[model samples]
Every structure is written in structure tokens, then in C-alpha cells.
Target: MTHVVGEACIGCKYTDCVALCPVECFHEGPNFLVINPDVCIDCGVCVAECPVEAIFDEKDLPEAQREYVELNLRLAQSWPLITGSKEPMPEADAWAEKSSKREYLVEMV
Candidate 1:
């Protein structure tokens, strides 16, 4: 199964996971990072690097976090993969500082 990024990652869109991803399966959203389940090799490398412990194996994810798995895969289907690192993007802390636990809002979208 694939790993999912949970509510804890909201706004804390750290690129550490993205950087460690071998297939470049991780994608960026307006406020967080999502994994492309179709492309993910399930290496678990990105999960280890997440400072917020937001990543989870699909089967291990909490019931509340389940939607994130679909969100990741849904987002992956249409979003482009990142090929290179950029400069001075929003830091995890910066995003975290302003992030709200908005998992419920995702359903409204």
C-alpha cells in the first residue's frame, strides 16, 4: 500500500520528503505535499524524514487520516512531478506556524 500525508502536514509543506523521494512521486499542493501513489515505490524514505511525522503507510493510517491517501492519489493524477529543488520556498516551520488542522475542509472541496 501507499503512504499518506496527514493533517499534520497542512501548511508545513516541507520539501525534505520530496527531496528524499526516489521516484519524484511527491507533489506540492497549495498548502502541503502529497504523494503520487501511482508512482511511489513505497520506500518509506520520505516518511522517515518528515519532521512532523505526518506520513503514514496506507494500511497503518488512522481512520481520520484515510482521506489523505485518496487526496494524495487524486492530486498525483493531475499534478506534475517536481524535478529540482527551488530556493527559499516556504519552510516547514513557516507553514506550520500558520497551518490549521483542516482535514475536514478537504472533504468540502
Candidate 2:
């Protein structure tokens, strides 16, 4: 199964996972990153690379975060692919501990 970027990644937008990804499956939004399910190789590399522990295998996703599977897919279609690591959002550290960040997600770049 594909991996999904969950709500914990919304404001943090850490790109460590992107750098480890073998395929150019990650897409960057204004404040987050998503994996393109169609291009993802089902590799678990990105999941361990995520500092916030926001990436999960689709089958292992928590019920509370299940919506992220669709969200990642939808956003990946419109956002630009991210093949390299970039500095995370300015307040990444501050946002990392904050839960329920779905409301802060920015759909556009």
C-alpha cells in the first residue's frame, strides 16, 4: 500500500522524507507535503525519514487520520512535485507538537 502524509505534517512541512524518497512522488503545498499515490513505489523510506512521524502506510493509517489518504492524493495532483529537501516552515518546531493541524493546511502553494 501507498504511504500517506497525515495532519501532523500540515504546518511543519519537513522535507526530510522527500530527500529519502526513491521516486519523485512527493508534492509540496504552501504548508505541507503529499505523496503522489500513483508514483509512490510503496517504499517505507519516507515514513522513517519523517521527523514528525507523520507518514504512514495506507493500511496502517489511524482511523482519525484516514482522511489524509485522500487528501494526499488530491493535493498531489495540483501541487508541484518535490524531489529534494527544503527548509521546513519557519515555525516547524513550534508546530510539530501541535495536534489536529488539518485546519491549518494550505491547499495552494
Query: Which candidate tops TM-score?
Result: 2
TM-score for all models, in order of appearance: 0.79, 0.97
Superposed by TM-score, candidate 2 places the C-alpha of residue 37 at a distance from the truth, in angstroms, of 0.4
Clashing pairs in 2: none
Enumerate residue pairs that collide in model 1. none
Cα lDDT of candidate 2 equals 0.92
The parts of candidate 2 lying over 4 Å away from their true place are none
Please write out the lDDT profile of model 2 over residues 1-109, one tens digit for every residue.
7999998898898999998888899999999999999999997988988999999999999999998999999999999988898999999999999998888898876
lDDT of each: 0.72, 0.92
Candidate 2 root-mean-square deviation in Å = 0.7
Q: Which portions of model 1 miss their true places by more than 4 Å?
A: 84-91, 94-100, 103-109
